[model samples]
Target: MMRRLCWLVMILAWSTWGAAAVEREAQRPAALSVYQDLGGTLNVEQVAALPEAVFRELPERRFFHEYSHSAFWLRLQMSAEQREAHRHWLSVGDPRLSDIQVYVPDGNGWQRMQAGAAHPPESWPVVARQPLFRLQATEQVVLIRVVGDSLLVVEPLLRSDGELLAQRRAIAVADGLTLGIVLLVVPLSLVIGFIMRSSLLAAHAAAVLSYILLVCVVNGYLVHWPMLVPWTSYIRAFASLVGFVCFLGYLRVLLQVARLPSLWARLYDGVLAAYLASALWVVFVDHVQGRFLTEWVMRLAAYGLLPLTLLTAWRRGLPLVWMAWAVPLLYLLQFLARYVFQADHLPWQARQESYSISSTLPGVALLTCTLMTELYRSRARQRWAQQERSQRRLEARGRLEAAVARRTEQLRTSLDARGALLARLGQELRGPLLDIIGSARRLVAMSSSDYPQRIERNARSQLELIEDLAALSHRDELPGPSLRAGSLHAFWREMVEEAELLAARQNNRFQWRLGGNVPCEVMADFGHLRRILLNLLGNAAKFTREGSITLGLDCLERDGQRVRLRFSVEDTGIGIHPDDRVRLGQPFVRGRNVEWIDGFGLGLDIVRQLLEGMNSVLHLADDDRPGSRFSFEVCLMLAGVQDVASVEAGA
Candidate 1:
């Protein structure tokens, strides 16, 4: 394979080298005779009888032969009008062939024919600028009159390849190559695009159409088939313009710029319209070929659109960035070469060999490969994220199962302990109660003064302790799942009322200040929320014995979306120290101040756990609050909620 590739490389290199060599060799000037009859004294028959063999051996065989100079050659001293008419007749064949060197006898010397002149009137009938033509054995020259008798001979102006046939061939070849490449590239682009699942169908359609236009232009111009020139040129130019616009459109779609159209996009559209108008102008306007310069300008403008669109796409972080750059760059090089080289005359093999040997083909392949690689890399990254998500989900499920199992075990143990405690309490209480009641009854029956009163008081005190234990054991079983669509204002109002009651019970003044009516409604378990509020309020009421407490509510908005609801309850009593803050929300944790408080240290821990379960959060409001502000923000469910929309509209 390597060897075969190397051979192909060598063949391409040789072909390119050969084309250059041929061009260099072919462009050299060919030497020939020039003839002109400013004075038309020469006869038509004499001019026509002139040997055409001189034309073929340009710069080689110089002096042309006539049938043995003296034999029947015209010696008529014609007038200038006759000379002009005769020479004009000769000149009618081909302008490029009119100039030729012929031998004209002037005494013993021969002078060459000048361009547009066969000979000088009254002198020699023929002129030879150089004596390269072989003389016949019987040929002889005789002198005529001094100045007027001598025919003028001038050197033939060697015409450069007038038709530029080689150049035309080169151009034709180049054009054919371009068209062939387009044929290959366009179909291949679509095939590869399909394989890659590219959504560039419109752009690809434009490309194929553009390729067809290019093929038409190539056939018309390079092949010298001017009949197809006008229509094909219009189509070619229009198609190319549309192709560029379509490329821009692809970028716009790929980058999702329609979501937020930019200035560049509008301008790109304008430029594309202008390009189409320019193409249309070529069709309607007379002498439109003069506007080929304008077409070039339009092409340049189209070329610039690529980078501008690419820059815009880059700003938007489009996945097609590299493709955007590569696709245009590939075509740009070819476009530049096409115009700059003026390759109208290049041959097909030379042109194909040029582009094929260029880095363009491989560059295109590399570009496609690069895009594929990027897509693959993008997919790989996505796959990795999915795998990570799956792994995380599995880990989260395991932790959740463990937590459920642990909670179940804890509940079972707690239930068993409660049962045993209840059984023991019943046994102890029954004996004591029976004895006390019996004694009290006997005393009441005997009317014993002090014994009856003491027995009744002891029994009453025992009943009070048992009632307190029972009350502690059943503090309103923690809230169940009863979601309520309640207004934030209503919830805050209820929280304030509950906090005030708790504060009054604890001999504390809960300073409840409502900031404003937060119109947002939340969809959440009202019971769980009430428990969260109660824990904070109860903890505050317990800890802050004298000082006031403040609870605040705020709604937050971001990116035109309502996302959060913050609830904070602050205390002015001894603030939680920094060291204990981290430990505050742990189960069974008690700060020094907390240890001195009346109740268990499980309120904040329950609050934290409950909030976590509800996907709400609990945190210290800040590092520098005057006192502890236990705050948490729940993400509001915006679905089926209308307040957020109203608020946003008002804002």
Candidate 2:
């Protein structure tokens, strides 16, 4: 009886102690003050049950050397004694965490709520820009694990419903402002680029877009786009490369880097290519090696860019370009101090402020200002050129008017001699006609004797070839392309045979091919088509020396009864520039790249006129290589079987 009574007393004493411990936990603050581990590979149970004595022993050092593989763990506590449950939330400092796992208190075990950079925003417990988790103050213990691919840092804070709302409102305002700025600048930059045809402006705009996207990623807003979040690492890695490429391209144009000596320009191009290759590596391969290669390339590029370009442009009086160096300076500084040296020993709040979106602001602003200055300068130059052109036009008009008045006066004075002039002109014309008849009679007399038959044959061929030249010279008065039923392939074959003959005369190699199984017959103008091909081939041969000329014909598109025939003439000669292509079809306007080649530039003009007559259009592609290519497409009605006989006769 005495032993039983002792056991009952021991049980009653243990129950009383347990009740007192529960009461102390209930009295704790509603907000979680501090967490336990900063960096480790610990799981939720390991963290939650960690002895109080163990946490008190370690000093807080947020920066660890093995940050890439380490995980950050935080312990949160709340009283389960509340009269009514209230909404609470957890906030993480860094936005680029690769993984986030939250452990909430359950009946017997912990309940896990998961999120990460790779996860969609909607899947998160609380869908905010950064990782946010909904909570109730009734939970006993909550734990969070943060993982990152690179250096990982953790900053956790518990907030009430009111605090979260206020924070969200502030974030909304900042986001709106940022998006508004981006929206306004993108279109404006595009418009300026279009108006001035400045590649620098276009590149600047692309850089801005890349900058915004990078910001979205580093700030965790990219989670909103579920499809894109999966490529978070690639996107983050590519952002720096894209920005650098665009910025460098802008500088290349604005600073006239291409004006450097050929050897130096080639070196510069090679460096850019290396950087691009590294960037591509990062996108398609391992980010770790890619990041290293890209960083080294950027560092080496800095040597060429900083003193050579930034300082050089400043010396040449570009203030905006000079001011733009701040970005690189800050980036280098941040890299050297925080990333390279592993100097991120400060608390989470300070580190977040040091290397986030706020750091890129000044550089972004400087770039914008520089682009704006360039835009204004472009407009000013355009206006000045316009004024100068107008002044020259007026002067030319005045000179032309004076010349016309003087000529009119001369004509009026010469009216008295006009009758004699006409009589002399008619006499001269009659003499030429009589001479032609006399020469023919003499040639006939000689033909019966010893005149060379070759001379007569050559003379007849020259007359026939001159007939087409005569028709081309009178293109304005001549009729359009005469459409008729003909075997398109046979006609093209004949033209190719003729082109081979022409190319042979010029000692140029000629190649012609028909694409696929082309329709045997097409409703085409044999006469005009022959003229077009002959002109194109003749020009190709004239320009090409010890080189090749290629003629290609293919049916590009087909409808019910009509097919679009695509034709191309590519020649191993000096290629055309994009700028010169605009005036290519104008009579007597040769491409600047044509150099010393002898051409009145009438060949392409005639071809364009003929194609237009056939209701076709001409298209200039990138269209340039070690040589040049001129291409056109024409829609023609397909010929039926009955047209074959007529086609044979026409050919």
Candidate 3:
């Protein structure tokens, strides 16, 4: 019986303790339920529970209590001045709930006031169809009413309208996207701009990007919690000031003003720096008041800089003169609307400020790019035109110089030829007359047949030399190149025969080699070709005294067309020096080694002219042994049927 009684007692004790703990937990105070702009529904019982000090501090809090049927709501009369002030306040920034409070007048005294705070399940009573509410004596509202020290404090009430909430979220998203695009475009644009060496465009793009980034940051923080709050407002104001100063600095560097007045430049830079330093202080320090109002001062200074840049560019017309006006003009309209019309709307929405500035900047940049391209093209055209004019002038001078040189050479050649001709004529007349006189004397003294023979041989040799001179004179005065068909192989054989005859006079062997499978017909000035070949053969024979001279001919086919016929004259003689090679082709310039030999230097000069007239080339072939081999190549045109017939008849 004792053991069973002990178990029963323990169970009762445990049950009693559990019940006491549950009752204690139930007696604890409920958590604070804070509300902003409660619409005429706050309970007076809950307000009466609040402490007097909490009631006095209510005005500092931001919560509004609405009274639906109060005389203050229905019969509130505002003067024109008061209404204008209210409207101006609304235009400046978003309106905030100042405070929410409850108060009960002390019975019959009104000097002593009792404040109330709203609590859970407490509703303010309605009397005479009006919601009776009392204003607190302070700015802070008592959101929580604790029975004792054990009550829990709740989070502050978040005050926001539906439109503001949505706009804040949108601004955040837009700022993120803008930052992303800037990150991508900024680095790439900077690299490309640096590579291209376009400092103005680079600096402009960077400054614009930085400005955009600043706007995004400011707008994002602003649309959320920090915009209207006094501390954050001051910080943002200062940040904007810094951005403005940075923009002006970038503009100054990009414009590259070297000759601005020293006093003005230093003053402008100093002011910008001062504003920027003030902005930095605001960012770091708290409780820097008047942030929203001070924004105006910075904006005024910022806008003033634009006009200064414009006046400077206008006066100087320095680098990118159009940019000074273009950028400022686009910004000017929007700036005026902000200060004059007080358009402090957000940047993303299509309100007055946003829409105007949004379209203006891109348009200005594109226009500047277009103008720059046009200027570059215009400068290029001008340079090209000038170069063309200069080239034409140089060509005219060159032609005049060539004509003068040709006339002077011709006059010199005429004088030399005349002198030689006169000397030859004197010799010819003296010899012939002496011979005829001797023949007559012989005849008078019973002369023999030998004297007559001697006279005939001398007369024949003199006649042959005169005929050669006459042919040379005629060749020198030949007509322009007239194309005609002729036998290529037959012409070669004639030159070879003439060369062999000349070689026989010098007791030197002569050899000829000819190669071509075609009909060996060509259209050319035959007289010029004949003279060129004769000169080549004569030079070969005149130089080679003991060894053999060889003449070679071949017709070449290029690209399925008869292009050229080549002639080579090789002689076993003292080879020409490398330095004298070009000199041999000049008129009146005999090779040094050939000065002891016979003949004037006119042969090769005349040969070069004839070859040039036929559009041919003469080259000294590189035999490089103990002898010289000079070769000639001429382009040949196809012969017509009538030309072939004439060529065959001439052959």
CA lDDT scores, all candidates in order? 0.50, 0.65, 0.51
Would you estimate the TM-scores of all the predictions?
A: 0.34, 0.49, 0.44
lDDT tens digits by residue: candidate 1, 99-210: 2333445454554433211223223222211111222223232111111111122122111242234433554454445344445545665665676566554344444445
Q: Candidate 3: where are CA atoms >4 Å away?
A: 1-173, 184-192, 212-246, 253-256, 259-263, 276-297, 315-323, 345-475, 478-541, 548-601, 604-651
Tens digits of per-residue lDDT for model 3, 295-399: 444555557765775677667766564555656675676576655665555342223223122322453244335335544655787899999999999999999
Q: Write the per-residue lDDT of candidate 2 for residues 1-651, one digit (tens) a residue.
A: 336534543553454344334323322234443333545556777777777545431133232222243566655555564314453666655666778888887877888887877566567786656777777656766666766764455555555666566656555554555465556667677687877787767777776767676777777777667777777877777776677777677657655566544654665677788888887876677555666787678767664454465555556565454435655565566556655676765322244443354444444455566666776778898899999999999999999999999999897667536545544554455555455545666687667753433344334434433444444433332356667887777677666866787778767888887898578778877776776777777877887777899999988888779888888888886566778866878977987767587767877777787787887766655733667777788888888878878656776
lDDT of 1: 0.50
Stretches of candidate 1 off by over 4 Å are 1-14, 19-188, 200-209, 212-216, 220-238, 250-260, 287-375, 378-382, 385-389, 392-651
Residue pairs whose backbone atoms clash in candidate 2: none
Question: Ranking by lDDT, best first?
Answer: 2, 3, 1
Candidate 2 has a TM-score of 0.49
Count the clashes in each prediction. 40, 0, 16
